[model samples]
Target: MAQLRQWATTLGFSQIGVADVDLSSAEPGLMAWLARGFHGEMRYMASHGLKRARPAELVPGTVRVITARMDYLPASVAAEGWQAVEWARLQRPDAAAVSMYARGRDYHKVLRARLQKLADQLAALIGPLGYRVFTDSAPVLEVELASRSGVGWRGKHTLLLSREAGSTFFLGEIYVDVPLPLTEPVTAHCGACRSCMDMCPTQAIVGERQVDARRCISYLTIEHDGPIPAELRPLMGNRIYGCDDCQLACPWNKFAQRARVPDFDVRPALNDPTLLQLWRWDEATFLRLTEGSPIRRIGHARWQRNIAVAMGNALAAWRDRVLTADEASLRAQMVQALQAWLAAPTVTGEAQAQVAEHVHWALAQQHAPQ
Candidate 1:
């Protein structure tokens, strides 16, 4: 077990644990959240039904599951400068705020390959194991399993939290038939800290360990399809990809560790990019830049839709401040991008009409009485 821990650490994993397949305790909460329609348009969460809690039922012969957590803070993030950098991004209305996690190579690819390698190493010792690896895949109760296995206690925000690593990490699981010894669960350490709840822009974290994903900015920007809710659009701030307010506000994150792998480093296009600059990218450019990114999964249409909201947020921010030539240049570039989008042959009927309306509104704002 000590050897496994050392090996996992060398592979960039912060911690590893073994959890039993019996997750009967979490079934009720999962059902209740689904019943409340908190999942919004993500029907798969409901579609999977109770199978998410019953690992053996989801995957036959799974007696034990090995869970791993890998810290994702970029190596480039200065120790004392993390919060300042994130706050600065939030203030720049023209800048698109992608969740720190998604700015890197798709974590799904990175974690899965490494996890399979770990499983292969185990097989070399024990010979012929029935195992399957998953990282954020559907039909998995990843966080619940990780917490139960002592990777960390569940935070008030409901994400698995570690004292040494906080919640800024990726989780991967290996379901196997072997009955590996289980790890001791950790006690919750949230105490009086409600910062994650208080800082949630959309009030998505309704209570301790409860999040209404329907109202989460991360859900709205990424998982959701169709029109974004009007009420929530303004609350999304400048986050064009995913929101990290809850995570950023947590005091425990002061202990968040940096990623050892270069694969988790920020891509230039996603780092400190202006809303107008990203909005200017055509479908081809979007595809080329986001080829290996999780953002690419949403495709170009949703990407533009997200950027349009940020552009709207930027316009709203500029309205409150005295404008400068640089700001005016940004607004002009936004207008030009909207016009280009309007002319695009592949723009969805719904998105095309929405873009046209936003363009007209933006143009009217330019000429409105000050």
Candidate 2:
């Protein structure tokens, strides 16, 4: 087990642990979350159903699950006071605040390839082994496995939280038939801390360790297709992709570690782009810029829809600010960009129409009553 840990560390994985395949204890919570329609438009989560909890059923002969954690905070985020920087970015109404995770190359690709390599190394060491690797895949209870395997305890926000890495890491799993020593689960440290729940802009974290994906900005912005709910759009603020508000509010995140791999570094295009700046990206530009990034999965139309919602929120947030000449000019430029998109002839397809509607709604917020 120690040798495997050393191998994982060398591969840029922050931690690795083993979990038994039986997850019957977690089934009830999964069912309850689904029954409440909290899964939102992510139908795959529902379709996977109990298979997520029964790893052996999903993958025959999978007696043990090997969970891995990879820290993904960009090397640039300072060891201390980085959350403050993120909070300040969120306050800037015109700046597009993408989730810290999506600013780099797609983690799904990074983790999958690395997990496969780790599997190969294991096979080399202990003769042939049967294993299947997964990263953010729907049919796996990733967080459940991670928590049970002592990678981290599940926090109030329902994300895996680590004392060493906070909640700022990506999780991957390797379902293997090998009988490995199970790692003991850790004690949770989120005692009496409601900061994550209180700080949610949309109150998506409804209860202790319970999140309603229907109201989650990350889900609404990234997973849901078609029009974003009118009520939630205004609350989304400048977040154009996934949200990091809950993680930022967590007290333990001061211990968040930086990525050892360069693959997770922030790209220039994703780093602190203004809404107006991102609003100007055509489909070709969007594709080119997000080529290896997970943001591209939502496609250009959803990207536009997300940015339009943020633009509207920016307009509302800026309405009360005493603007300098440059700030006023910036607001006008954003308004012009919104109007131009609204008037475009090609913004007529069903997907593009949703984006156009959002663009029109953004234009309307400029004069909406305070």
Candidate 3:
């Protein structure tokens, strides 16, 4: 077990644990969450059904699962009181706020490749091992697996929380037919803390350790397609991508660790970018800038739509504030950006029309709050 830890550390994984394939205890909760229709538009989650809880069923003959954790905070964010820095960025109405995790290379790619390498090394040692690697790519109960294997306890926000790394990390799993030694589970440390629920801008965290994906900002921005709900737009503030308010609010995050790998380093283009800067991007520019990035998955149209929503929120947030000469000029520039996108689009077909609708909504925020 200790030897496996060393190998994982060298591969940018922070920790590893062995878990039994049986997850019958989690099936009820999974079914309940699905029954309530809390999964929103992610039909895949429902389609998989209990296959997520039964690792052995997903991969035939699997008897044990290996869970791995990889910290992903950019090296630059290791400064003291980093949560304050993120809060300051979110407060700036005209500044585009992207989730820190998405500021670099796609996590799915980074974790998946490293996990495969780890699996390959294991196979070479064991001689023809049958195993499958996963990193948020399929129907699997990742948090349940990690929690059972002592990686971390599930927090009130339903994300894996670590005493050493907080929740600023990615998780991956390997299912194998071997019956490896099982690791003990950790006790929950959340106690009476409700910081994550209090910090949610949309009140998405409905109960202790229960989140409605329909209201989750991360799901709404990254997963859902078509029009964003009008009522939720104003509450989104300047967050143009996935949100981090819950993780930022958790007290344990003061201990968050920086990624040992450079793949999570923040891109120069995403660092404190303003709404106008991103709003002016043509489809080609968007693709070029987001190459090998998770943001590219949303395509240029959704990117523009998200920014338009933020731009509208910015206008509403500025309506009551006294403006300086530069502030007034900034406001005018934002208006021009919205109007220009409305008039001439760089996207085509349904994408262009959807973005156009968002632009019209953005242009209509004069007396409104958002």
Q: TM-score for all predictions?
A: 0.95, 0.98, 0.98
Residue-wise C-alpha lDDT for candidate 3, range 1-370, written one tens digit per residue:
7777888999999999999988999999999999999999999999999999999889999999999999999998856798999999998888999999999999999999999999888887777889999999999999999999999999999999999889999999999988879999999899999999999999999999889988888888899897989999888988989999999999999999999899999999998899999988888899999998999999888999999999988888777778888778878898988887767787899988988888888877746544
Q: Each model's number of backbone clashes?
A: 0, 0, 0
Give the poorly placed runs of model 2, Cα more than 4 Å off: 345-348
lDDT score of residue 280 within candidate 3: 89
- Local accuracy by lDDT, each model: 0.86, 0.91, 0.91
Candidate 1 residue pairs that clash: none
Question: RMSD, model 2, all Cα superposed?
Answer: 1.2
Residue-wise C-alpha lDDT for candidate 2, range 1-370, written one tens digit per residue = 8888888999999999999988999999999999999998888889889999999988999999999999999997887899999999998988999999999999999999999999999999999989999998759999999999999999999999999989999999999998999999999998999999999999999999999998999999899997899999888999989999999999999999999899999999987788888888888899999999999999988988999889898888778768889888888999988877767733446887788888888888887575
Judged by TM-score relative to the true structure, which candidate is superior, 1 or 3? 3
What stretches of model 3 exceed 4 Å from their correct place? Answer: 368-370
